[model samples]
Target: MIRGEVIEAAMYEAMHQAAVHLPPDVEARLRMALAEESEPLAREHLRVSLENAALAAAGRGLVCGDTGFPLFFVRAGSRTAVDGGFGAIRTAAAAATARATRDSFLRPTMVDPLTRGNPGTNLGPGMPKVELQFAGDGDGLDIVAVPKGGGSEIFGTFYRMLYPADGEKGIKRFVIDCIRDGCYAGKICPPAIVGVGIGGSSDLCMKLAKEAALLRQLGEPHPRADVAHLEQELLLAARSLGLGPMGSRGVNAVMALHIELAMTHTAALPVAVNAQCLVGRRWCAAIDAGGRIACTGTLPPRETEAHA
Candidate 1:
């Protein structure tokens, strides 16, 4: 059985790490963009982004001032048992968010929608959203934390009930149109990681889109050849739109395009688009039956190197 305190401590560490470190894949993509960018302004922006990432890695401050919202995706083994039960995980997450706020690793982003009152601690209705799934029979738990900023979330789009005849062409059109119309102003941060989820119900489509945008490594292709090709095609098309870095019109319009698909009803097609800014922040960890934690995906450079 996993102790409640152990889960809480692991979650706290994950939250701080995610807030302060830029994922390796994201940093690499930004560096590659910097090398390819010709526009002086865009190049400068990329440079500043890298510098900020380096500073955050050193624990100087958070990668972004906004710090965004705390989101967790969890996979728990069927046999795994927590001392305080499943509710313990939620309690741990809430306490982690509060600590992150106190340490200034996270901003107080949660507020009462109606009153707009700040709760000081990042806890309230719908705050620290958690999505859970059960898998396998081993006594273990896996967790991923994604801190999504307001700008990107604001520009996300979902559409349902498109004719099956639209198919690939229709999906491509929806994605490109969303970016051109909603993201051209760099509201979601340019050279963004765009995720397209096709098929499934409305909610599932959006969830898949988010997972694609936030979980998958940059430039990694989907396993299916057809989906991979579609990702490349969309990436090319988005670049051709000239909505380059920060929407200032440059060569690199997108960091990557990831697509996730699921089988749906014969007549119904649902699609969703989700975006992640250049600063994509996520970290993951797994706790074994023995209560040992193994973590990955972007810690401080010094810490990572030392661990290596």
Candidate 2:
């Protein structure tokens, strides 16, 4: 049986690296948006975003305090036996998070929604949420951690399609409709990432959308070609609406659109849209049997380097 301490160190480093390593694609999208954006307000937002990214990296601190509810995606190897039992993974992750909260950088965003008080730590008996999937036979682990905040989450919405033919049209409408709805209601922070979950049961659809955000690489292309095409179509339609950064008005609003799907009952096509704000804080760390970290990366780079 493999020990947990070695795994814990690697996981902690991974979470740190994930916070530091913003992937290239997401960075490119933001840089391009900054260049193309014209309106004073929208452009200003872009500038702040760039600076914030730089600051997070330089300080090695979290970009935003909304450290988000930690979501864990664990792919455990079949041949590897966990030290204590079936649940050693959770304990390892929580241990990693405690170190992440104290050492590197991440804010304590948890609170009592009713009392309006800070919880002081990111740990709950089952906090730092996690989802596990077991596959393969090697003694390795791949973990994806995402910190989802409240402002963007407040805009989350799901709609049950009344008819089958309405699926595509309904999706388009729901996205545009949700943004519009947010505009009218005046909350969803703009320049958001939209995750669309299609054709899954209600619960599955929601999970698919949130998981879609963790996929992270921009324009990575969905494995199912049709869904990939739909993502492009949605991007065009969404930008054309003039929602711009913070909905103040510009050429581009959404940085990217991510879509995921599941085969569903023919009678129903349930869809859910999960919105992620500009302050995206997610990282990934891979570990092996020796408890050594393999790789670490983040969704956006903390800074922009000028070309020579």
Candidate 3:
């Protein structure tokens, strides 16, 4: 059985990784855009971002200051046993959240919504969001930590429910408009990563949007051909908006676009949009049955995934 302490350690490391090291895929996307950005200011923004990433990775400091929200996605094997079962996952998450804040890897950003009371430890009810899943085959655990930025979540997330007749045109319109608005004055902090969710229930679409934005590998195309085509069209539209990093005039406003879909009610159509700032903070780690933990460059499998 894996001990709770080991889980906490793994979680803390994941948190630090999320903050200090932007994902390789995300960095690669920025570099790809950097190569094409001709506007001097826009190109400089990309250059600075690359330099910032290297500086943070080399132990100078974190990639971004606003540590936003602490989110943990965990997958467990059916054969794996923990010291405290499901409770251990949450407990370790909280412990890791507090530890990250204490160690200066995370900011104490969580608070009481109604009273606005600060815990100063970044631990409150549902502060460090945890999503859990189980698998039938593999023996151990995989966790992905995302230091989701507050700026993007606040300014770039949106939802709309339309009649089924709205169709793909409506979907495209909604997404393009959201991107135009979200990147206005560089509020969403381009070059942003955009995620779109369609055909799911309201909340499910929102969750899918959030996951698609933060979890997927940058520039990886969706497997479904139709959906992939939509992604490409919206991506080009987003870049054509004359918005660049910090509102510069260039094609560097959007780094990537991804969409996740689910079957929904026949009568209703739902869509959600989520975005991530240029920081694009995420990290993955795997813990073996013996409690040995190793960080992986590849992202963790989602709840929507199945074991092979």
User: For residues 212-300, could you state the per-residue lDDT of candidate 2 as single tens digits?
Assistant: 65555665667668888989998888778777776677756677788887878888878877877665556667666765666555432
Question: Per lDDT, what order, best first?
Answer: 3, 1, 2
- Global local distance difference test of model 2: 0.68
Sort order, TM-score high to low: 3, 1, 2
Off by over 4 Å in 1: 298-308
Give lDDT: candidate 1, residue 90: 90
Off by more than 4 A, model 3: 301-308
Which one wins on TM-score?
3
Instruction: List TM-score per model, in order.
Output: 0.93, 0.86, 0.95
Alpha-carbon lDDT, every model:
0.81, 0.68, 0.88
**lDDT per residue, candidate 3, 146-230, as tens digits?**
8898889999999999787899889999999999889888888899999999977899999889888987888778878998999
Candidate whose lDDT is highest:
3
Worst 10 residues of 1 by lDDT: 299-308
The true-versus-predicted C-alpha distance at residue 150 of model 3, in Å, is: 0.9
